[model samples]
Each structure stands twice: as structure tokens, then as C-alpha cells.
Target: MVKEALGFNILRAKVVTFKYQTVENMSVVKEKIIQEIESIQDEEMLNNIHHVLQNIYSKKSIIILNDEQKVKIAQAEKDYLEGRFYTTDTLFEEIING
Candidate 1:
């Protein structure tokens, strides 16, 4: 029983640490975004960023995505940044029309 309790405590500590690390990672990303926004000078680029943020904030419901979906979205963004994504026109022409 004591060994079982010790195992439970270790699991709980791991969960707590995971949650803390998630929040810390988000805070780091938020700080980086703020720093980049402060350094941005182009009006059009800022406006585009503002529009995207507004769209994000305008969501009416709290949509809870599962871990797999989150991982897929992160991977998609990484692929996009690495120039491994398809263009809208190409997608429309090939997948949408064909």
C-alpha cells in the first residue's frame, strides 16, 4: 500500500509538472509575440496580424481540441514555416476543381 501511494504521488507530481511546463511555454510564446509586435513597423502587416488575432478572439464557443488535433495543427504550422505547404490557388485548382 505504501508503494502504491508513492507511485501515485509520483504520477501526480509528473502531471503537475506537465501543466506548469505547458503554461510556461505559452508564456514564452506570448512574450516573443509581444516583442515582435513592438518591433513591427509595417501598417499592412500589423493590420493583417490584428485581423487574424481578432478572428481568433471572435470565436463564440470554447472549442476543446484533443491532443492529437493539437499535435497535427502544430505540425501543419511547422510545415508551413518550412515551405512545405500548398498554395491556395494550387489547392483550388487541383483538389477543389479536379
Candidate 2:
């Protein structure tokens, strides 16, 4: 029983480690992609990449807002047009000071 428990614990540890490593690997991949994008000088290649990214983004499921959410969004838009919104910097300053 002791040996079996030890084996199970080892397997669980491996699974946990694998999950963490996958997340870390994804971060590394994202960083590499950013670096590659920054280093690319070809405008055509950049445009192609942008087009592919846009297509990927466009395929995502569209959000269907409820009536309450739609009303809130409309109010927010009205406020924006009336210049009732704080700048991001001002918002962050208020948050930090508070």
C-alpha cells in the first residue's frame, strides 16, 4: 500500500508539473512570436500575419448581449460622447492614490 501510494503521488506530481510547463511554454511561444513580429521588416509579411490574426479573431463566437447589457452599453456610449469619462492615466492615478 505504501509503495502504491508513493507511485500515485509521483504520477499526480508529474501531471501537475506538465500543466504548469504547458502554461510556461505558451508564454515563451507568445514572447517569441512578439519578438519575431517586431524583427520582421517586410510589410507584405506583416500584412499577411495581420490578416491571419484577424481571420482567427473573426471566427470566435459573437457575444449576444441581453437588453440590460445593451442599455448599459448605450449609456456608456452616450457618456463617452459627452466627455464624461476619465483618461486611463487619471483613472490609474485615482486608483493608486486611493
lDDT by residue (tens digit), candidate 2, 1-98: 99999999999999999999999999999999999999999998898788778767897645556689999999999999999999999999999998
**lDDT accuracy of residue 54 in candidate 2:** 75
Candidate 2, clashing residue pairs?
none
> Over 4 Å off in model 1, which ranges?
59-98
What tens digits encode model 1's per-residue C-alpha lDDT throughout 21-73? 99999999999999999999999789778777777898764455668999999
lDDT of all predictions, in order shown? 0.89, 0.92
RMSD for all candidates, in order, please.
15.3, 15.1
Model 1 shows how many backbone clashes? Answer: 0
